[model samples]
Target: MSLLDLSWRNMKRNIRLYTIYFISMLVGVIIYFTFAGLMFNEDVVTAIQNKENYKTIIFVASMIVFLFIVFFILYANSFFMKQRKKEFGMYILYGMKERQVASMVFYETLFLSAISVTSGIFIGGLLSKFFGKILMNLMHYKDDISFAFPLEAVVSTILLFALLIGIITFQSYWNVRRMQIVELFHAKEKMDKPLQFSMPLAILSVLLIASSYYTITMGGTSNLWKDYFKESLLATTVALIVGTYLFFRQFSGWILQRMSRSKNYLLGNKMLWISSLRFSIRGNTVNFTFNSLISAVIIFGVGFIAVDYAVKADVVRKEYPNDMIFSSQDNRTQQQIEQILNDSHPILAHETITGIQTEKIANRKPFLDHPDYYTEEFTIFPEAQLNAIVDLRGVGEKVDVKGDEAIVLTRGIDQPKTYLSTLPTMTVFGDHTFQVVERIRFPLLSIPTDASGGSEHQPSVLVISDEAFEQLKGTRPITSYEVYKIEDPKTSNNVSRQIYDIVKRTEGSYYSAFIDMYSIDIESSSLILFSVAFFAAIALFALASVIYFKQLREATEEREHYAILRKMGVHDNVMKQIIWKQLLFVFLPPLLLGLLHSWFLLYYTVILIIKDLPALTTIIFSVMGLYVLTYMIFYVSSTSIYFKIINEKNTR
Candidate 1:
């Protein structure tokens, strides 16, 4: 028989073993092709209005997918070769040259790669338009997308897969050269060696993981501990990687031993399951650790993306709660502002807030031990104007300032101690002082000069009685703001963007600053949301591939032990149960640990990125649900494959 005929027969015989690799490659190529089509989609490009952005996303995402596919396919090739080492030894013993054995293996890999890539591209092309619509929906694009051939995408995918197949074939050819006849025959049994661990190493692993969690949570906060920021972050990341590996390496066997100590638990096939888990752990420490970290990375990365998108979208409304605010110097400018406001949309209501500027303003917060804080000049308003604007905007109740008391609009301080402790009194321009009766939160009439853009300042806006305001009046420059509320605030978002564009076109406009809430939300959220969602999908698919490939390898190695159990009167039904239980034991630990890791990640993420954004809670829960569903599919598929492998009647 020809060598090609023999290779074809070998491939047909071992097609079941190649299932994981085949599916992984197919999925990878499908994603690549679908994204390529979307990148070239005319309607999508028009809707996004940025062709380069879509192109860049597709290019970078494709490269990431390609790299993952290369690593996965190469690893799968080596794993299959390792599993068939004994068969290769038989070939050598039958007077076949090593070169002939290597060529046969190469041919099998070439055939499988060709089939996977071809099938994947055909399916991907069919689904490309559907995924394009999904992307358009995510980006809030209104263009009606239609399907196309995406000939360039097809050619590119084929070329990329061809290169990948070539690389895989080369790896197979190189791998068999190093295999000796004796070692090849004993390759499958080599993993049965006993594992050793020390108490000190085990303790060290726990300490490292503990310290990593601490650093990630509390060590990165600023103010006092800002200097060691880089060091703490670096230490935590390293500790997590090394500690996670060591933990799985030593902890696996230890767990199995402890579980076996209960006599009732070790009864029947329970002990066999425990034994199988121990063997999997001790022999595959690196694989277990790798899969665990991959799981953690998927959860952490996807969770963060969801949180960031939600926060960015929410921040726009929080920053600009009112419809529009524009500063004017005098009546002429104020008239222009009113004209533009009326032109933008039907203004339901408007408020004119005048600021009497005062410098060298001293508040109690700065004089306290918090000397690092500095106070800026403030715009003081009288009680009546404050009440008029507050009531017109329907934000807060009108404040009553009594005697020498004033209401301070504080900005930029999250902690109450830093803001409220020094608010007992306020001094304006040299030595004039007034008692502070109340301090309101944010969104005052005039635009805040602070970074937060809210009323979170140290006496930034002081509201006093008209009589007191008249007394402190000086030659200092005055600033004014014209705040307007439109009849339909939601529809006015587009009008707000148009007005902003008009202002940009016309130089020296009346409005010193413009706040368009909807425009800000849409402009920032679209790119961030799309990029994060795309990358998350890529990472998740890659993680699934890695875990799936690893599980298949484990199933292949454990087949013989299961065959023995079948011979010892183990029924097929009982063997199926044991196989699934064992697979679950292997999969669940890493999944649970990954969730625990995400908990620590989200703890800090909520406080920092999604600060005070209540909407993120719902978004986070939804993301978690999606990830769990994906994991469920992976688990079910893994169990099914495992059951099929261990129940086979022939296990030579």
Candidate 2:
């Protein structure tokens, strides 16, 4: 028979072994093709405001997918080659030339590649429009996405995977050519040396991981982050990676060794599983460490994006309380705006807030860093006008200030005690001292703050009693803010644009439209969430597949050991229990560690950025729960497959 026929027959015979590898490659191709098609889709490109940036993001994401697929396919191929070494040795024993054997393997890989790529393209083409619809929905675009298969995308995916197939085929050829006959025959017998537990290394691993966590959490508040931000980040990353590696490398082995000596080791099936785990832990250390780190990253990345998308509306509302806001004292301009807004949408609340901008403000807190806080002017409003505006919007609580007391409104989400404590308790305005009694986090007006202008500092507004405001009003220049809350602000894009045009025509005018900012924020957050979610899914699939492949190989290697145990009267039920316990040991540790790592990372980082902590927590835990469920499914599937492998009747 020709090498092609032999290769095809061999693949058909070992199709089960190739299933996971084939699925992983197929998924990779589908993701690449779908994203490439979306990037080239005329509808998506033209609909998005920042077409170039959107294309760039999709291109980068597709490239990352390609690289990940390459790594996954190459690793699986190498594993398969290793598993088939004895077969090749037998072929050599039968006097088949090494070149011919290599050629057979090459043909097998080529056939698999062609099938996967063709199937992936067909499936990806069918799903591309569905993905486009989801993307457009996330962007809040009203237009429907029509299905169109871009030939360029198809050609690109074909070319990329063709190159990948060539590389993998060459690798198979090289591995086969490098194998000595004797070595190939003994390949399955090569096991890693037993690990010896080092007390110092175990302790060092704990210390390193703890130190890494400390650095990440405290780095933001310490001089290390302030003086050397990038270096600190690098150091933290290296420490965490090395610590995680050592954790699985040394600490896990040590624990398993200790368990092997424990009284519980005498329990039914415990000895069987624990002994096996202890023996194999050394070889599996790198895989365990890699799985742990990738799991953590996926959890953290997906959780953060999910929470960000969830709270996007809250964030937009907090930053912009009014639907339309612009500073205008011109009667003609105000009348024009009122006429346009009243024509289409009902004005929910219209307030002309009169305030004074004064640079004569003193008693600024020493802890505040913004030079603007100490030098720049502050907009001071009377308690009556502020209360009226708050009542009109129905957002923040009303303030009741007496003669000498003032309420401070700052730009940011409210943090209990943090903002109140940092703000000065007293302020001096043009020689009149007033006590600052209360602090509100969200800005009452939609005027731009220093933060909106790309500065780190937030703008402050002082609200005093009408008596105190009258006392200081004549000392500073007066400013009037025309703020309006219109009906259905989310759909007020046309009115918002017209307002923006009118406001921009007047110099020194400040304008903010809720719809304008909301649209941008929602679109960007949705896109990020969509992208990160897919990326996480791919990573997760790869992780699970790797673990699955490892366990399958182990099952094959341990089949003989099981057959011996069976002859010695070990029941199938007992063997099944043993397999379950063994798989649990392999799957649970990395998942628990990953969950813990992601929880800490999000609590310290995302909690500070998001206002609604309870909602954020819910989203995070929900994501973690879903991840755990996926792993559980993998664990169960692995266990069943493992039992099936070892329980098969011996052909020998």
Candidate 3:
């Protein structure tokens, strides 16, 4: 028979083994094709107004997808070559030249790659429009787009995969030509030396991982170690990576050796499983470590993306309780603001909030007890006006300041006692003294404007009785706040844009934290959320396939060991249990370690995103659930495949 016919027959005989690799390759290509199609979709570009940056983001993402697929294909191909070394060795023993063996492998690679890539692109074409719609929804684009075939995307995917296939085929040819006759037959028997754990090295690994985690989660609310942030983070990252490698290299084998010493635990069936795990884990340490690290990143990255969106949404809602807050200290008046709002659009519900604006005394001691408090003057509001606009009881007790007493309205800053303890009586503008009654919270106005038109170092506000406000003969500037709620909240973003444009035309430097926060929310939520999620999905699938294929490859090597156990009166059910236990040892370590990494990573994300532990915990759980679900799929499949391979010998 010709080499082509021989290669085809060999592939058919080992179709099951080839199917696993084919499916993995196809899934990766399909994902890549779908992402590329979305990137090149004309309708999607038009829906988002054809932003060059969006296109750049999608293009970069597609490149990453391509690189990931290439890595997967090459790695799987290398392992498949190793698995079939015995078969190839026999062809050599029968006088088949190395050149013919190379040709056979070249043909196999060509056939498999063609089938997977073509089928993958075909499937991707069918799903491209749906993928585009999902991207639109994720980016919050309101415009509806019609479906169109992405011819450019199809051509690009085909060319890229064709090139990838050529590279793999060339690589196969080179690898086969390098293999000697006897070495090929014994390639599968060449296991790495038994792993030995050094106590000092193991201790160093623990220290490094711990130090890295500490460095990552350092500088709590106040950013206490801000100066050390950058250098420490870089060092910690390097340490964590090296430490993780050392941990897997020595930790698993060391622990298994210790466990084997326990007579009761390591007796009989347990001994066989432990022996299998110990012998196999040394060779797989690097892979398991690498996979664990990637899995951790995927879990944390995807979870943090979702949590970031939720946190930004919450911040936007809290900061902008009203749709717009138009404040100006210049010749701009309440009437001008109202006219601008009315002339451009129909008048929606609006309210004008007025407050007394006074500069704080530069260095005045209000109360002698608190040294950390930097006392400052604040805009004072009368009880009637304060109650009209703000929730009094929600912050502090509603004050009935009978005489000269006044209450302070404040935000939830860290050191409340340092600020509140000295608030019973305070001096304003160097001469005016007022009795403090209570401290109310500022819900929407936590951050106060500074001289530079940003948040001040300290945030403070005062609330006094109406009688006190009217009786004040102090000469201080008074400011008015005009808050507006749009008729439709859905159009709030567009209205904000319009208002910003108007401000720009008038050369106004009106600063609204709410507007700035809202803009950031919209931009980041759209840009980062979907991209990270897509990569996370790809990482997850890659991880599952790698672990499944690795376990499946070992099935042949392990079959003989199981055969010996069967002759010694071990039932198939017991052997199955042993396989499950052995696989669990291989699988659970990486997953659990990855989860440990994810926990610390997610905690650090919470520090930036929400700062509320319980809320972030909920987000973490939801994200972890997605990862666990994906993992279980491969775990079940890998275990079943392992069982089937081992049992094949028993059918004889």
Which candidate leads in lDDT? 2
Cα error, candidate 2, residue 492 (Å): 3.8
lDDT, residue 624, candidate 3: 87
Q: In angstroms, how far off is 156's CA in candidate 1?
A: 4.2
Write candidate 3's Cα lDDT for 1-652 as tens digits: 9999998998998888788778877887788888887777777776553257677888898898899888888878887888888898899899998778888887887788788878988888767777777766665555565555477887888899889878887877788888888898887676656566676777788788898888767644436456666676688778888888878776667777777778676566878887777777777888788888998888888887777776665555544444566554345644555565565544566556667766754543343223233236566777776565544122333446666777665443322333344455676656667876554444433343211222433334567788888766356666666556544443344445555555445343333434444544554476577778888888888777777778887887878878888898899789878888888877888888898888898777564656664577777888888888888777877888998998787885
**Candidate 2's residue-wise lDDT over 547-648, tens digit each?**
888998899889989999999999989999899889998999888888878887887888765665567778888999999998899899999989888876
TM-score, each model? Answer: 0.76, 0.81, 0.75
* 1-652 per-residue lDDT for model 1 (tens digits): 8789998887678777666557767777887787777767677666553456557866787777678667766766777777788898899899998788878876776777688778877888778778777766655554577777577888888898888877876776677778788998878675655566555677787889898887776634664248877776788889988888888887666667667777677576788787667766766677667767766776677677667665554454444455676554456645664676677566788888777867754444643333224246667888888888777777667777777877766433322232354557677776778877565655463333221123322335678988887777766666666677776564444455445554445353333222333433453455456555666676666566566766776777778877887788888888878877887777677767777777678767563655677766676667667876777688888888777766565744
Rank candidates, lDDT, best first. Answer: 2, 3, 1
When 2 and 3 are scored with TM-score, the better candidate is 2
- Stretches of model 3 off by over 4 angstroms after superposition: 92-100, 126-148, 197-227, 234-243, 317-322, 325-348, 352-482, 487-520, 604-614, 649-652
Worst 10 residues of 1 by lDDT: 448-457
Cα error, residue 213 of model 1, in Å, equals 4.4
TM-score of 2: 0.81
Q: Model 2 misses residue 480 by how many Å?
A: 5.5
Clash pairs for candidate 3: 360-377, 406-437
